[model samples]
Target: MFTGIVEELGEVVGVTPTAQDSVLVAVRGPLVTSDARHGDSIAVNGVCLTVVDVDGGVFTADVMGETLRRSALGTLRAGDPVNLERAAALGSRLGGHLVQGHVDGVGEVLAREPAPRWETVRFRLPVALSRYVVEKGSITIDGVSLTVAEVGDDWFSVGLIPTTLALTTLGTRAVGDPVNLEMDVLAKYVERLLGARPADAPVPGPVAS
Candidate 1:
């Protein structure tokens, strides 16, 4: 699990083919690697990846076919910047929200409107995941937790302050760029618990303690 707080802006140093579809990603992030060991989970742009090896400030993680097909990570090339965050430790303050580092789907930046203190970015939501997002709800984009300011049937927007713009990849992202998106975990859990049966469907069995 993660807090969706970006610790460092890392760069993709290299990508080597591991198998027919899996690729080994070599990333360089001094802060994230300072205490990283083999098997440590590091979120690279919202995708939880286990460390396979560490050499100096560089670490390698395997990207399977599903991850590649579901996120913008596949579009990354050598030298591309990526958001990096270490897994949250127990008892740590949840600075942001509960981020599983699991990318549910991908979205595309539709527009960017600059403000005096912040910028509002609008993204076209993928149809499959649109039902989970809500206004004022937490959402993880490229591993950084943000609140949805507004939501439309097919789009949503977030406000980015200077710190976010300076520290994360979203700062330089342009229109049409693909981004990894993860919706609120709590919302999904609630939906699953409450939406188990149809409204008109009769309940079965007795309640258990």
Candidate 2:
């Protein structure tokens, strides 16, 4: 689990393709890798990845085909900046809602409305994930937690303060750029609990008269 708080902005040092459509990505993140060891999980651009190797302030992780297909991480190349976050500790403050570091789907930047101290950015939400978003609700974009300022059937907007604009990759995201998006996990859970039973679920029998 992660808190959706970006601890560092790391750079992609290399990307090497492996067999079966998987790839090995090497990232340089001094802060996150300071105490990282093999098998440790790190959230990079909102996708959870396990460390495969650590060398010279850089760590390598294997990006499976599934993750690549589901996230914007597939577009990453050398020198691209990525948000990095270490796993949440047991007693740490829950600065953000519980994040599984799972990229539910990919969203594209639609527009940016700049202001004196803040900016409102709109994103094209995937149809399948739109129902999970609500006004003023929390959402994680590219690993940074933010509140939904405005929501439409297929789009949502977020107001980014200067701190967010300066600290994370979102600051530089241009229109049409793809971003990994994770809806509030709690909302999904609630929807599941209240939704109709699964196809394989046994139907309730009629009460005996």
Candidate 3:
């Protein structure tokens, strides 16, 4: 699991395709690779990728077909910046919310409204995923945890501080750019529990005391 806290802004160095409908992605992250080794998991742009090889400050991971289909990672090319975070260690501070590094859906940046202290960026929320978003709720974008500043039927906004704008991939993202999104898992669990049965459905029999 991850904490949705970006530790470094890494750059994609290369992408190589394999015969098994998978691509090898090599990312350069000095900080993340300082003590890295094989068989490690790294969150790259909100998608968890296992380390296949680690050489110097660069590490390579294979992106399978399913991940490519569900995330914006497929569109990444060499020189693209990605938010990088190592898996959370036991008992460590949960700086951000629980993140599975699983991209639920992709969203597009609609607009960016700059302010004196921060910027409120609006994103086009997918119809299916819009219901999971709520104002003041936590949302993961490109592996960076952010709070929902506003929400609409088909869109949501998040305020970005200067630190976020300077350290993550969202800083350079332009209008219409696709981003990986993961909503709060707790909300989904609540929805599932609430929708488990119809209002008129009969409850199961209880044991005799």
Candidate 4:
């Protein structure tokens, strides 16, 4: 698991196609790759990718066909900047929110409104994922955990401060650019649990031990 806190802004160095429509991507992240070894999980732009090799502050991982179609990682080319975060260790500070590095859907940058202190960026939400987004709720866009400043039926806006704008890829995201989106995992779990129970199911009372 990850905290959605970006440790470094990495760059895609290479992309090579392998068998079964999988592409091996090498990213340069001096910080994240400092101690990375084979099999370590690194989140590249919100997608959890396993480290296959690490050499000279660069790590390579394989992206399968399913991930390519689901998120914007497939559109990445050499020299493109990517958000990089290493997996969370036990007992670490919870800086952002619980980010699984699992991209649920891809969204597009709709518009950006700049303010003196911060910028409000709006993204087009997928119809299927729209119900899960709530005002003031947490959302992960391209691996950066941000709060929902405003919400509409098909879109949500987030306020990015100077730190975020300077550290992450969202700072330079242009209109119509695709982004990996992961809604609150807790909300999805709640919906799943509610849907699993029968309509007439009774709520059991607490039992005294």
Candidate 1: segments with Cα more than 4 A from true spot: 198-209
TM-score of the candidate numbered 4?
Answer: 0.97
Per-model C-alpha lDDT, please?
A: 0.95, 0.95, 0.94, 0.96
- lDDT per residue (tens digit) for residues 57-145 in model 1: 99999999999998888998999999999999999999999999889999999999999999999999888788898989999999999
lDDT of 2 by residue, 1-209 (tens): 99999999999999999977899999999999999999999999999999999998999999999999999999999999999999999999999888999999999999999999999999998999999999989999999999999999999999999999999999999999999999999999988865767878876789999
Q: What is the lDDT of residue 37 in candidate 1?
A: 99
- Candidate 4's error at 208, in angstroms? 4.8
Off by over 4 Å in 4: 204-209
TM-score for each of the candidates: 0.94, 0.93, 0.94, 0.97
Compare candidates 2 and 3 on lDDT and give the better one: 2
- Name the runs in model 2 displaced over 4 angstroms: 196-209
Structural RMSD, model 3: 2.6
Total clashes, candidate 4? 0
In candidate 4 the C-alpha lDDT for residue 108 amounts to 98
Per-residue alpha-carbon lDDT of model 4 for 1-209, expressed as tens digits? 99999999999999999977789999999999999999999999999999999999999999999999999999999999999999999999999999999899999999999999999999998999999899999999999999998999899999999999999999999999999999999999999998999989996689999
Q: How do the residues 1-209 of candidate 3 rate in per-residue lDDT, one tens digit apiece?
A: 99999999999999999857789999999999998889999999999999999998999999999999999999989999999999999999999999999899999999999999999999997899999999999999999999999999999999999999999999889999999999999999989987998889886688899
